[model samples]
Target: MRKVVFHKLCAELRSRALLEETFHVTIEEQVAMFIHVVGHNWSNRPIAFEFMRSGETVSRYFNLVLDALCILARDLVCIKSIDTHQQITSSHGRFHPYFQGCIGALDGTHIPACVPMHMQDRFRGRKKFPSQNVLAAVDFDLRFLYVLAGWEGSAHDSYVLQDALSRTNGLKIPEGKYFLADAGYAARPGVLPPYRGTRYHLKEYKGTREPENPKELFNLRHSSLRTTIERAFGALKNRFRIFKCQPFFPLKTQVKIVMACCALHNWIIEDGPNVYVYDDAAWYEALPRSVRNHTDMHQENLAWAKKRDDTAKMMWEDKVGQTVP
Candidate 1:
């Protein structure tokens, strides 16, 4: 800065300004990421000093960015760009590529957070740590359709969806049109979750009895659709390694960073072909069937638990509103 001062920095500033202007995503997209994902430890004195021309710039600009992401997520309808096709088959075989008739896969991920002293207990979840459970829904092409935030870690995945659906009525998929999800979600008309038991690609088996006839067939069909989401999540965490780390910030900051990483994921997938492929075979081969079965049974079951679980869900659903599409 001392050597180059205004002249050289001005040119770089102009380039940065121009870059920001061209994207269709509003300034919120820029700001949210600037704070949450791109600028972690931004408040640390020396680190802040390194990035900002002035010390106060980060704080001054932080809320400005936060407001923008909020607006972008609420108002913008993202139109996907995918090449869909259909194959010629007289009767039996058909193959082509498009969005692959896959709408989206919904999942919940817990982000570690610095919970407030007063409410820390409310946020402690499965791992016995303070965290925030964020629920996001994405299309088969791995683009985010909707993201709902502010869910407590202890809350069930089904509860998260119910809250999002009730709060945002527009998200209701039309009749017979469904978004695929793991068994963690509730079973309703427009949301199709996998059937319990048995196996399919990326499916984790729970101890519940294997699904009967048509349900098994439905899961088989849905597996092809849902894999995209898993792949998308894997790519996202891999690229933004910090997201994989336990969040040790305020709950509010956790939300901001989560959204930022998601935007970053979309940005990369849209701009390039760096989508990640998971080593599911490696993970599966290393894990025993009994362990996999035990893990799957627990994690994939937010909808129907055992007798204790089922009863809890019944009570929880009453408190957590249900929206039928």
Candidate 2:
């Protein structure tokens, strides 16, 4: 984090009464300790040695800062807006009119978890070690809008998303606005997923084997847009060492760490310099948006399917029209 952003964060914490200076340790030191621990994935002992504080004091301050940051997450870790984003508008040839209503992109990533031996089974997924399925929504600028951490790694991404929607203050999609999701999620009104069993993912569309049909074209574009969430995850795991290493904190703290890390990521993106510059070339072809409707599940599925088909048809026709003499 930049010095100015760090000072502002400290000030915000003080103003909000989330954290305060103590007789021995200042807020700056406390926040620095927390950042060092997460950024380096250092244990309490190493943190204590580095900060010249006792292990107990280091642990206490770490938890305090973690809690404070999590409290701050409620505001910092939210969608920028429901309106059409400038990223699409500015790049008119890319995702502008096609994905106009796309509020953002969402996906789930597994973060290392520290769980009891008895509970490891539930937490362990395809990963050899136990992990948690963390769901997050990120805008075009690579800033997180919503984040739901602590689900068991074994849990399906779709299940985690459903749980998020079920919460009283969970993931929300404004009417007529939607988020791009991967094929792992079922396509609904406000969550647009690419066509299953179709040619998706940019790697597949490489070389001479380009999209052969409307569904393939749609899937290709969907993969291109939805890759934003993946890039966000990559940058996050790369920045925060806690996500890369095995967490030694309690299971609950591990979960909070996920949230805290996401909040910090957004903070760095907004306040700090452009560390992770948005890749224009990578996001050349993009995604789709959706509407908020609670009609019958079958009907809603068909509606969204038709929506995808229509968008794909339009994209394909444009491609063909441009090629014609």
Q: In lDDT terms, which candidate is top?
A: 2
What TM-score does prediction 1 earn? Answer: 0.59
In model 2, which regions exceed 4 Å deviation? 272-295
lDDT per residue as tens, model 1, 1-325:
1223323322332343522433443343334335443434334355345554354554545544544444333322232322221211121111111113335667877766677788878788885677777787777567765666667788898888877766533344433234667877655544666656645553433565443343343454456657766777676666665665555556676687667556545544454222332223232122122334545645544333232233333433432343333
CA lDDT of every candidate: 0.51, 0.83
Question: What TM-score would you give candidate 2 relative to the actual structure?
Answer: 0.91
Q: State every prediction's TM-score relative to the real structure.
A: 0.59, 0.91
Please list all clashing residue pairs in model 2, or write none if there are none. 78-145
What's the residue-level lDDT of 278 in candidate 1? 26
- Model 2 CA lDDT for position 179: 91
Q: For residue 10, what is the lDDT in candidate 2? A: 88
Clash count, one per candidate? 4, 1
